[model samples]
Target: MSASPGAYRAPGAGLRALQLLGIVWTLPNTLVGCVLGVAGLAAGAHMHLRVRDLAIVFHRWPWGPGGALTLGNVILHTGDTLDSACMTYAHRAGHGEEAPIVLADHERAHVYQYMVLGPLFLPLYLLCGGVSVRNRFERAADRYACEGRSWWPW
Candidate 1:
């Protein structure tokens, strides 16, 4: 018997396989994130798994300048809360809480990039101009957060 149209359904086998592949491909970066997460936890950060996003997030990470950083599927956030809302602490000109972009979505785009690029993501990200808006990856992630599509820089 089938459930209602809006009922939750498990992912198909092929989709699960692809998800597993992504997890494996991004393991190295995830490991680094895990290490940092552990350190954050030791320093009093709170951790939780966001099932819908399939990400581990550490809130109040005790580092960085009041924003979020994504490594693999892990998000290290430097605030008491993390959510799909425009980040007021991002310090971008003319963008505030009412901005269309969501911080969590932007970080999720980075997760997708790490899944596809694997270990190459960090070096390539640095070479592409690091955290600045000039970076293609940053631009793509911002676009993804604002438009809800097209996360890939290329």
Candidate 2:
């Protein structure tokens, strides 16, 4: 079952076990995100735990495209705040204006993707077309952000 956008469901014991497995599976990518996040921290970024997503977020990251990037369970946000607000870039004229895609929701989808793909997510993301609307991963993430469901690329 899928939760509403920005809503979080508490995990039961079985789900917790699965979450643990995902954490281990995505450890490599998580480590890479951590290294970058720590560097950002050293550069004056602030760190916060997003309890709902079970992810680490670095706000005011000194370097980035002025939006956000998700690597494993870590999200590096260029802005001072990361919330359920729709991202400027994700907004388009005459498209889903009533229910714009939320930035945190989108990145959370990437976190889920990382949990499933682990080390392969980055390579496959590039192979599918990096950071473009045409990319399957991006599409899936957008869908998840907009509809709050179906984050899987397949």
Candidate 3:
């Protein structure tokens, strides 16, 4: 059972500050995501919002969530199953609600990319031929997400 609307918890002050930093860090991208999010919300899409460490995460299905992170830390979760941006499936698994838990690292990597590459990240991602680990952006994000993790089993 999901939490009722009355049960929704507001993020803490520190998390709100970090969320502000993220908005400043990503700027235009965050703005775009906000616009999209607002539109989705206006259209009656169900929203799940939270702060995962330093990032403000959201889940609103029915717009065909791409299971990838975009606009810094904003995750577009449309799939029935959760997968991190590195293309790894969720450790425990869930519907949209589990996205931040599963895809936080991967999405944060994209946030870093937005910081480093600014607006260029998008076009470069496009120019690199889009949506594959073969793409430099995707590869970099994967590396960032997987950093310091031991990969032996899966």
TM-score-superior candidate, 2 or 3 = 2
Candidate 3 is scored at a TM of: 0.58
Candidate 2 clashing pairs, residues 3+ apart or interchain: none
Each prediction's Cα lDDT score? 0.77, 0.83, 0.51
lDDT (tens digit, per residue) of candidate 1 on 1-154: 6442123357789977987788799898988998999899988899998754557999989988778888988889988765646632233634444355667777777888988898999999999988885788987887776667788999
Which candidate number maximizes lDDT? 2
Candidate 1 residue pairs in clash (backbone atoms < 3 Å): none
TM-score of 1: 0.83
Worst 10 residues of 2 by lDDT: 87-96
The predicted structure with the larger TM-score, 1 or 3, is 1
**Residue 11 error, candidate 3, Å:** 18
Best by TM-score: 2
Give the alpha carbon lDDT tens digit for every residue of 102-135 in model 3. Answer: 3555565566566556566688768876765356
Better of 1 and 3 by lDDT: 1
Off by over 4 Å in 1: 1-11, 87-98
TM-score of each: 0.83, 0.89, 0.58
